[model samples]
Target chain A: MLREVVVLGVGMHRFGKFPETSLRELAGEAGRRALKDAGVLPRQIQAAYFANALAGLLTGQESIRGQVALREVGVAGVPIVNVENACAGGATAFHQAVLAVGSGSCDVALAVGAEKMFVGDTGRTIQALAASADVELTHDMGLQFTAIYAMRIQKRLASGALTLRHLAEVTVKSHRHGCLNPYAQHQKEVTAEEVLASRPIAGPITLLMCSSVSDGAAAAVVCSAEAARGAPQPLVRVLASELRSGAFRSGAGEELSTAARTVRAAYEQAGVGPEEIDLVECHDATAPGELLYYEDLGFCKPGEAGRLLDEGATTIGGRIPFNPSGGLTSRGHPVGATGLAQIAEAVWQLRGQAGPRQVQGARVALTQNSGGWLEGDSAAGAAHLFAV
Target chain B: MTQGVFRSSTDGEGAPSLAGSRCRYCARVSFPARPICPWCGREDTEPVAVGRRGTIQASAVVYHAPIGFTAPYIVALVELAEGPVVFCPITGCLPDENAVPPGTPVELVVAPARAGGAPVFQFRPLGG
Candidate 1:
């Protein structure tokens, strides 16, 4: 029998570009905050997993990233492992920590994700992101990331299932919620008109609609539920962790079903369904990506995301609040740190500590993050379901 | 220093056909030829030629192109009638509903890739 893992504490270094701040400082801030919140001393951490992507190419700090970052918080001599799985890096590390704690390999495990992107120039930054795709296939395409969603959005538009206004609305709502989140990279709210007026990066996705190339870190402290019993902090249960990578590409369809596969696995593990979810913090790398996820994850019926949005189901006061943390669009997508930041947001919401963006009485939360792109689907998809 | 995606050759009827790979064990087609079958992982793959005709399964308009590439270029993921989906740029195409809609018929053709020019496989609208 697997022991139930509990998140003792979670912390986030606000997602943004801090040119002056080093990656170590960003990771240390979040790690220290998590340890402090969990009432855990640095010496108590038995193992650490650091999650990051593009640091080697951009920062020249490749292996032992966890040791370099966690050492700043006085964690030493513990086994520090590093993992990189594109945008899912953070959640991947967190899942490893959960497994470590549940398997009795370690009583206390720390998962920290830090990424420093947008390095000196746009060309270099884009080149780093292109590593997520099969560079051999897509490198010459001269477009990274956003184009895939743009094509899907174009299809939706052609089908009359969506319009540019709908796309802009998604960005507007994300920014509106981001304003309530102090940790969000883009905190100021903007109108749909402003979103439409913003610079276009891909078809129907304006610059504001894209997740910022962010630099930040987030950390989580995990242990068995029994171990967290007396901790002086709110305990969030790690109900389920599910991960799925893109299957071998065939001409089956344009949309990759990794999210669907992972969510099903997660629901099975958690003994819950999408209908039971109270709120969500998903990877909205772009507006269309979120809309597609709503359909793929079965939050709503297939081809019904537009209607669901029309019903205001994903807004703060809606029946199922989505991306209450502003998602990647506004909260920022720091590649390595994004997944843990999502978990942090969920923990805060479950603890009733989310000041303005709280989803009332949120008891269960789901997080969906996908990374990299191959063929027409995400190469890696990781979904997490958390409960109080 | 650019090369064609496939070493094109004349078919039985003297029409140029795109070179690809056929799974000797499963018969699944791979564009530009892969030694191993992605669908079945069979290593008995043989090089074959594919006709240029395909349908536009998906498409995207990139407003912000990478370095040395111009913006506002249209690229599509095309599903060949034979097998496999090929993601390639569409010449003079747009992602508008009035243009380059999914399911639109396309024919692969050799075209200049960048400004200075290198031979590359591009697709063009068959009709309308």
Candidate 2:
């Protein structure tokens, strides 16, 4: 009943502190690159979804963000929709684009995510990031996202499910991958001693183990299968795309974590399981997050994520590689831009175009991007499966 | 303190009691008191006081603070005896020391959120 959707092209601007770059410029560059890669003009795009989380709070560009940014890249005269879902905005936009094409509404759609966090004021950016949580209850609580992750890690550490060594090791791996990624913000590899000795942000999390505030943009072009008949690039099918919101979880209940629930739905939609995944681009905002998601994404059972890391299973050459683009910790988390950046990485690897970080023989790739925090879970969780 | 989050003690000498609502239809309880139950979308709910004593489920000493907050403060998620978790600052504990470990019993108290700021509810290690 529904048409098949495929990703035609993807593009990204490097992630780092680009104080001289404007939001429009950042978005326009990525959008233009995606169009060029797809061999399509801006006018060919029937609908556009622009994702930016902090522009309203950080840059004061409240409404019509999509229209304003896309117009600079000759993306006018199209129905542009703005999306904001904290860190998962880009994936949300992509999900909408896929739906648009699959529902027979449009043949070509575009999703773009961009953020400029180096606004010459660090305090304001931190303040805006904190607004992603329940402001009513946590405004006065001095809530930092690092602290939330630190708390979770502390509990696991106490239970002996993880160790300080595991945290440092995963960070080392992230940086090692980042060193091969030209777009990564922190490409220099770090030693375990250096990671442990670095400045502590919260609990056991060090400065090197966390993602930095970055400025960047990423974009993707989606089209119906018929539109991709003779495309220059290899066909990349959208096997599944799912987006879910956090439900009320009391922590004591048996309710699965939001990521688990979302990924399960994606697996069902795709008619596949974790064993079929060749590589993954998980939302590892912090070092330990990658280990936790090994279990959350069903790659391993509980209490065995550290073992998966210990076995070097998540490295580029290992089974089920993760964060081949250095992930958020090193790729730089420009918030809204992170999701699309992951998509771009997946597309590259699937097309055998990834220069140094490609997972050999990679075919099926999954991306799990989460955003915000609500009721002790990510407010928005998205899992999209792509195959070549 | 945010309005409708807590109420003054009857004797007016102790910390204000945290408020919540219990649904009559589904019997689900929500903190900060909701007019309607979040579980079943039922408007039949009653305001009730949640327990002030709880155990620290997790705690972290934040070195980087956001605006209006000082660095090196302890923030924690405590599971109240009444079966709800609340996120608040842990008072009466040095940031550098692991004085209040997870599972440590704590009692709610009112303290200034920041220098010269209005008093808000926080937790302190029992008998510390």
Candidate 3:
């Protein structure tokens, strides 16, 4: 049997433009905060797993990023493994650290994700990120992720599965919550009229519907449940942590299966279901991504996401609060740090620490993150269930 | 008879795409570009240029574009003269209407893109 693992502490650097902080420094700051929150010193960390994407291509620093980042905080001689799973890099690192602790390979482990991407020119940076898709198909077609996902939206809408208003509602709702989130990159509340008036980036998705690129870092401390007594008050438990790779039928059109499988695995591990989830933080790189995740995670049936949005089933005070921290749509997607931030958000909700956006009496929370494209679908996915 | 094929590069001697086959065992058409007969998936597959003219299978207008991308572009999936189908963007056409309608005729042209700071191949419309 696997040892039980619990998240002792979590910390996230503010999720916005931070041109003055280097990636290493950003990671160091988050790491230090996580250690402090866990009441553990830097030297007490047995090992560190770092998650970063685009550092090699965008930042000119590739090799040993984990070593450089961790050493900056005066923590050294521990195994520092660098993880690069595109946007899911952070969650993947967290999963690894969970494994390290659950498998009894380490007592105290650090899972930190950091990225510095806001310094570059817009066109170049976007082009580089688009390269993460199916190059052979996307390169010549000029189809970036936004365009590809937009195609899915078009197909769904054309099939009478969704409407433009449904898309607008999600944006409006996210913005409403985002306005209450001080750390959100976008805090202004917008109406559906304003969202509809935004510049279109793809068939149905507008520029305002996409996530902003930002620099940030997030860190988590994982240890056996026995190590949790000394942690801060109101402890939150890591009920389950799971990762699922690309499904064999990914490009065959039913790509949601990957995320579904990951969530299912997490549910099985946590001994719970979507009905028990009071809060969730999902990968909302685009407005539609969040909508689709609702169905994929079993919160609703396929194509019913639009209805869910209109009903406000995902709002902060709704049946299940989703993305209470504003999500990537407004919180900024710092790639590597995004996954960890999702976990942090879940922990905050579970511990009743999410101030204005808190889901009252939230006890069970879920996080779903997918990254990279394989065979025209999500290449990597991770899901976790947390409780208090 | 005159023959044609698609090259990986704009220049000759790049990579040749072949069509049809006359296997020593039995004559048949093998779609994959082969040095030897593809009937056996062996060294006998031959190299040939199947030419450019093709039938459009499907088409869509990309109303939303990626950053650094031209908006309102026409993209299509086409069955080549050789029979192999390819997906490409139909450039130089009206955002509203284009000969790129499904089952319409189309040809290939070279285009530019960014790859590791270098320009790469992108497909464009063939004719007006």
Please give the TM-score that candidate 1 achieves against the real structure: 0.93
Error of model 2, residue A252, in angstroms: 0.7
Backbone clash count, each prediction separately: 0, 0, 15
The digit string of per-residue lDDT tens for model 1 on A7-86 reads: 99999899998988888999999999999999999999999999999888898887878788888878989999998999
> Candidate 3 on A299-351: residue-level lDDT in tens?
99887888888787899889887899889998889899999999988887888
Off by over 4 Å in 1: A254-256, B1-5, B8-19, B31-36, B92-97, B110-112, B116-120
In order, candidate lDDTs are 0.84, 0.90, 0.76
lDDT per residue (tens digit) for residues B47-92 in model 2: 8777488898889999878778888889988888877788888998
**lDDT measured at residue A332 in model 2 versus the true structure, 0 to 100:** 98
- Candidate numbers, best TM-score first, in rank order: 2, 1, 3
Docking class of 1: medium
Best candidate (score: TM-score): 2
Better of 2 and 3 by TM-score: 2
lDDT of 1 by residue, B6-120 (tens): 5433324354456788998888888657888987998899878785788888777778887777877887888888967877788755545346777888887765556754556
Scored by lDDT, model 3 comes in at: 0.76
List each candidate's DockQ score. Answer: 0.51, 0.64, 0.22
